[model samples]
Target: MSFEASRDKFQAYLTKQGLRVTNQRLAIFDAAFAQKEHFTAEQLLDKARAIDDSVSRATVYRTLPLMTESQILREVDIGSGEKFYLPASGTNSQVAQVVCVDCDKIFEISAPFMEWYGSTVSLKLGLKPITQRLQVSAQCIAQRQTGLCPHRVAK
Candidate 1:
């Protein structure tokens, strides 16, 4: 959807949630939707400032946590006091991700991976699983023997 459409929709959503639609929130949503992949608050502030050139770092920092709490944005905690934010699209309550430890590259994986994994372990122990949050990280060294990733190849 277009940025304006998304902004209007999200504004309505926020209103339904009894949240005020501040100018900073709208700017943040625009920046978040326009940006691809995960971004830190500093990165978001840079983009927000590029658009308005008057947006503040403190606004971005304060607003991000509100978005996370409202479920409009998702935060990936890297466990180093660094949290990356992204628009809540593919992410749900059952989302799973594979993050690179060295470079902090996150690849969103199939959510069913969590359920399948939980089922395997629960069946082994003869127990029923209630909820699951399984995240795994791997560092795959690229080799010349294999072909390039389709997403990486130039058009």
Candidate 2:
């Protein structure tokens, strides 16, 4: 959905949860939506602080679950201790994540068959599937051969 729509939804969610639309939260939201790559909570704090220096780490940690639960941010775990967050694509499309073992990079690919596969398995067991996910862990062949991860981003 559009940013305005997402903001509206987030406002509604906060209201429904008896939370206020605080400035810090808005800064965190804007910081999150501004990111193009997956980011950790610490990275989010830095961005939010840049927008509003008063933004606190505790608020960032608390608001993350609210954003994810509100369906505006997609949370990803690459089997690493720290989780990553990215803006939700706002589609019902099935997506599969391919995580690079070498550089800890994540690539999202369309996997339309996930719906079909989930449904098929559910039908066999006489159950309904609420959600499904597919993740693949692989190493970069070029990196393996050259001892360099070309996709690695400097921290």
Candidate 3:
């Protein structure tokens, strides 16, 4: 969905939840949607503050769950202590995440077969599937061999 549509949805969700659509929240949303790469809460706070100096770390932390729960963002956990988030594509959820263990870089690849696998496995188990995720952790070959990550933008 377009950012405008998602913004409207987010406002509606906030109203439905009896929450006010505050400026800080909107700044956090803008910062999150502006990211082209996966980011952590701390990183989001910095970005939000850049847009609106009044944006607080606490607000960023609180707003993140709202965005994810509303399906405007996708949460990624790579067995690392910090959680990463990226804007939801709003097209397909059947994507696989490949994380570079050396650099903590994340790459998303479309996995159309996941839909079939989810249905097949759920049918055999007599259960309905709601969602599915496949995450692969890999070491950067370049980093391993040359001691440098070619796509290492992660901290």
Q: How close is candidate 1 to the true structure, as a TM-score?
A: 0.70
- Relative to the unseen true structure, what is the C-alpha lDDT of residue 106 in candidate 3, on a scale of 0 to 100? 93
lDDT of 2 by residue, 73-153 (tens): 999988889899999878855999999999999999999999999999999999999978899999999898998898899
Q: Each candidate: how many clashes?
A: 0, 0, 0
Better of 1 and 3 by TM-score: 3
- Superposed on all Cα atoms, the candidates' RMSDs to the truth, in angstroms, are 5.2, 1.0, 0.9
Report every candidate's CA lDDT: 0.72, 0.93, 0.93
Off by over 4 Å in 3: none
Task: Score candidate 3 by TM-score against the native.
Answer: 0.97
Ranking by TM-score: 3, 2, 1
Model 1 lDDT tens row, 34-71 = 87788888889888877777678888887787777655
Q: Give candidate 2 misplaced runs (Cα > 4 Å).
A: none
The lowest-lDDT stretch of 10 consecutive residues in candidate 1 is 146-155
lDDT of each residue in 64-140, candidate 3, tens digit only: 99999988999999999999999998887899999999989999999999999999999999998998999999999
lDDT of 3 at 27: 93
- Identify the runs in model 1 with alpha carbons over 4 angstroms from their true place: 1-9, 13-20, 90-93, 113-132, 143-155
